[model samples]
Target: MTTLLRNCRPMGGTAADLLIEGEVITAIGAGLPAPEGATLLDGQGMLALPAFVEGHTHLDKSRWGMGWWVNEVGPRLIDRIDTERATRRGGFDPATQSARLAREFLARGTTRIRSFADVDTEIGTAHSDALVALREALRGTMDIQVVAFPQSGLLVRPGTLELLDQALRNGADIVGGLDPSGIDRDPKGHLDAVFGLSEKHGKPLDIHLHEPGELGAFALELTIERTLALGMQGQVVLSHAFCLGDVARAPALYAALAEAGIAVATTAPPSRAVPSVRAMRAAGGRIFAGNDGIRDTWTPYNMPDMLQRAMLVGLKNEFRRDDEIAWALATVTDWAAEGCGFAAYGLAVGARADLVLVEAETVAEAVVATPPRRLVLSHGRVVARDGVLAS
Candidate 1:
């Protein structure tokens, strides 16, 4: 199938007609004639940008369709885990839940999502199964990457590592781990097991590092050490390394992270200072952003729109200038694509036809306003439009 996206402004450039044949973009030029039988998606001079690549999300714990819950207590990280297990042990279907969120995300111009599926002894491969099922179900609409995450500490739980292995065998794409020193209390042992699984399965790795201050920095150091030792340069990602921003040695840590080739993800948490995008990029680090939970057992707030998340990231990071805001937007788009393992993502000839047509005229305005996505195309097919499924 061929689709012609006409009169679309290329970010800050003039209007162009983008022709997509099947999945890859074939040509992009102004006033190009549309071929016969080709579908015409008139953008009407809307700003066109690459669709968002969600580098972090948890579908297993998503509370989109289920009733809402406001955690009234301390609601610490551990508390959320307990709440999730207690509230989600039974009567939870990941396929249906993830499918709904996929639609919502696509409508908001997110075409690819790397989601964490908790893999512990208690839940076993149940979560992985849900995500695997959803991945298959939403193959064309949304590219789903399921990470076999041991939400529970790997060494703390005796049989958890095996469960992680099972999750990977069961179809999870990336091998995931939690805070090494903070949660497991043994950074070496935790990372050894985590890296062992990735090596054994020949899969990439991403770990959640919500550890505070020096602890978080230590965890990242250990992770970087293992990543370098294993030579898994670009294949490893550290999500929520908020500790890098909290500690005084933040600049040094950022430089180290860049040298070690370890990517970091930030959700722009409300508590502390996060990594400086400029510094990280300057030191050769990739920074991506994703909404961790969507009205899940962990937090009350949830949004599938990566654009809105980009805005949050920009605002929380104190990005006020145009270039800074543009870079902030890339945190969910181009900058994120590399971290999420997307090889062909963007609005150019030979790139994957994953683009969004927004109502704003420029990229900065689009990030600020995030007016509803006019049209979202995934694999050269219309997936969503105007914040809903495209007809």
Candidate 2:
């Protein structure tokens, strides 16, 4: 497929024409003539951005409002999550909800996502199966990585180990765990199980951490040790270490993780400075943002806008110039995209033509305004045009 995108600016930079051949971008500049029989898109005054990437999402719980509505006013968000987890059933009709959310994300210019599906003995890998189907269904349209996540607990959930192994055997890319220490006082041991499974199968691991004190920091330390000790390359991710703030000596931990090449998926907001991010980034660590949970049975925060997550991180952090904020937001898109192995997710030549054109002339304005993805392209094909939401 050959296509011409004329008069487009990327991240509010110089105007250029984007020419895409097949899946890779062939050229980017103005005055580039379109090939014969090529599709032409008028990018007049639009800014092109790499497609938004959600480093973390829980697709298995994408839709759950019926039982959720009844349990309103839960004292804490996590509390609400527990309630939803307890009472929810049959909400995720994978065939319908997965396709629905895929289109929703495509329309929003998010072509890359790393979603988690809860795994356990009783569930029998049903979530993974559904997500696998969704992955194949959206193959040419979107990049979806399904993580075999143990939402309850690895040891706590009976047969979780067997089920996790089954999930990997069935084709899960990442091994996942939640509350390493909280699941069992022996945080290191629990992590060992998850990491051991990862090492045994040569898969990357992403863990969920809710404990904010020493245990949280300790869990991260153990992960770094395990990642290096096992010689696992690009095989570890720590999600939502929100309680890292409670640890008095987190800077050194952050620095070590950076040196060890450990990546973190943070849910950053202005109020939460996330000191760990500053120290980690300074130490050359990769930081990616994840939506974590959408309006599902699992979390009160159901808004699945990666742009909003970026905006929150920007507003919460103090930066010397606008570029810092732009870079931070782009991390969720560019850096996270790379982590998900989407090499062609940028505006450069040889990259995929999956790009979003926004209304703002400046990156700061674009992020703050969180405008509709003015133009969305996938595989050099225009999946969405003119910022019109798909019905």
Candidate 3:
């Protein structure tokens, strides 16, 4: 299929016509003659950008445990585990639930998602299964990356590591771990076992750490140490290393992480971590953002808007210039992907023809307002297009 996207501004440049053939972008420039047999898409006054990539999420607990709570509690990830378990076991179907969520994300312009599925046996492993099914079902509409995450301590939750192994065997792309310090208090040993298993299975890893305190930092350090020692070939993503910001170890830690070839995934609005991110980026560290939760038992807030999250990230980080904020918002889905060693998916020629058209003049305006994605295309195919087609 050939498609021509015309009159759209991208990366703060003059509007151009993007020519896509099959799944690859064949050309990108202004006023090129329409290729033979190409569908033309008018893009007047629209901001065209690479499709949103959600690098961190937990579909197992999304939109659950809403209300019926006394007070807003502390660190809701743990509470989410219990609530999610009951819901799944109480005859809530996975296929139906995941399909609904996938549609919601697509409707919001999110075409790529890297979601964590809990592997702890206590949680019954239903989430992992649902995610696997969701990935296959939404293959054409969305690119989904499923990580087999041990939400609880791998050591503490006997057979949990084995469950992770099972999930990988069943088609999980990444191995995951969470809160090494909170889990076993033996960060080194736990990471050893977890990464060891991941390495043995030849799977990449994504560790979730909230950075509780000095203890959490210690845990993250051990994780970095083991990943380097293993000489892993794939990316090692550390999500929410907020402690690097809180524990006053931004400079040194960021240097260490960059040197070791690790990327930090700060999904939430890091009100306390912008200086840390700036310093880290200066010191060669990479930072990417994602919408971590959406109406999940994990958070009272249910809206999963990565664009809005980027605006928050920019506002909290003090990017005075609108273009600077635009750059920040584009980081998570583009430059960050390159920094972390993934294939490019942008508007340039030879890139995947995956893009979104929004109702805004500039990327900054789009981030703040988050106007509905007017058109969404994946692999040069029209996965979604809002509004009626002209006669």
Candidate 4:
């Protein structure tokens, strides 16, 4: 299939025509002639950008398609975890909810996502099974990487390690772990179990490190040590690494993480401590953003919009200037795609034809205003328009 997108400003630059053949962009230039018998669509001079990438999220836990869920869980992380487990045990269709959320993400201009599926003794690999099916179902339109996440803690919950192993063997593409020192109280044991699974299955690791201060730093050190010892450089990511917020203690850690090729993901929660985006970038550490959980039992705040998430990141990081805001936008677009390992994702020729056109004059304006996506294309096919999924 050949399609030409005409009169679009690539990253708010000069208006140009983008030629897409099959699923890759073939050419981009002003007044490019469309191939004979190819479909031509008017871009109306909208700002063009690579489709958003969700670096980290929980696909199996979203209650988006359901009615408004009242969130009354305690502030503590354990409290939220217990409440979520009870809610899941009470019964909810993971496939249905995940599909709904995935479609919503696509409609919002997100073409790729890395989602964590809960794996515990109670639920086992049920979440992973559902997510795996969803991943296959949305194979062409949306790319999803499933992580066998032990949300409830591995060592603390007996048999969870085996369950994670099973999840990876079944279809999960990544291995996940939660706070090791904070939750399991044994950082070494927790890291060993997860790193062992990653080595065994030849998968990557995306661990959630919510441990604060020195504890979080210690866990991060252990993670980096394992990454180096196992030659897993660039194969590991640390999510919600709040410890990186400590400017005083972060420089050395950031240097080490950069050397180890380890990446970081942050939701940029307003009330929580977050890593310095500029500092990490300067230190050569790759950092991205995600909308963690949306309308789940854990929290009633948050939406599936990566653009909105980028705006939040900007606000949280105090990004005032246009360049800084544009950097924040990259967290969800270029940086997020790179961090999540989305191949051939960009607005350049030979890249995948996954793009979104928004009604904005510049990237910074788009990030600040977050205007509705006027058109979205995935794999050279129009998939959405005006914030709605096209049939």
- Model 2 clash pairs are 17-29, 212-243, 270-316, 294-302, 295-302, 344-352
Give the lowest summed-lDDT range of ten residues in model 2. Answer: 64-73
lDDT rank order: 4, 1, 2, 3
lDDT of 1 by residue, 359-380 (tens): 8878889889978888888899
> Evaluated with TM-score, which candidate comes out highest?
4
Give the higher-TM-score candidate: 3 or 4: 4
Error of 2 at 114 (Å): 0.3
Report every candidate's CA lDDT. 0.86, 0.76, 0.72, 0.93
Candidate 4 C-alpha lDDT tens digits along 301-381 = 888899999999999999999999998999999999888888998999999999999999999999999999999999999
lDDT tens digits by residue: candidate 2, 174-210: 8898887776567866888998898788888888877
lDDT of 3 by residue, 309-379 (tens): 67767776667688677756865578555544456577788988878888887777887777877887777
lDDT winner between candidates 2 and 4? 4
lDDT score for residue 244 of model 4:
91
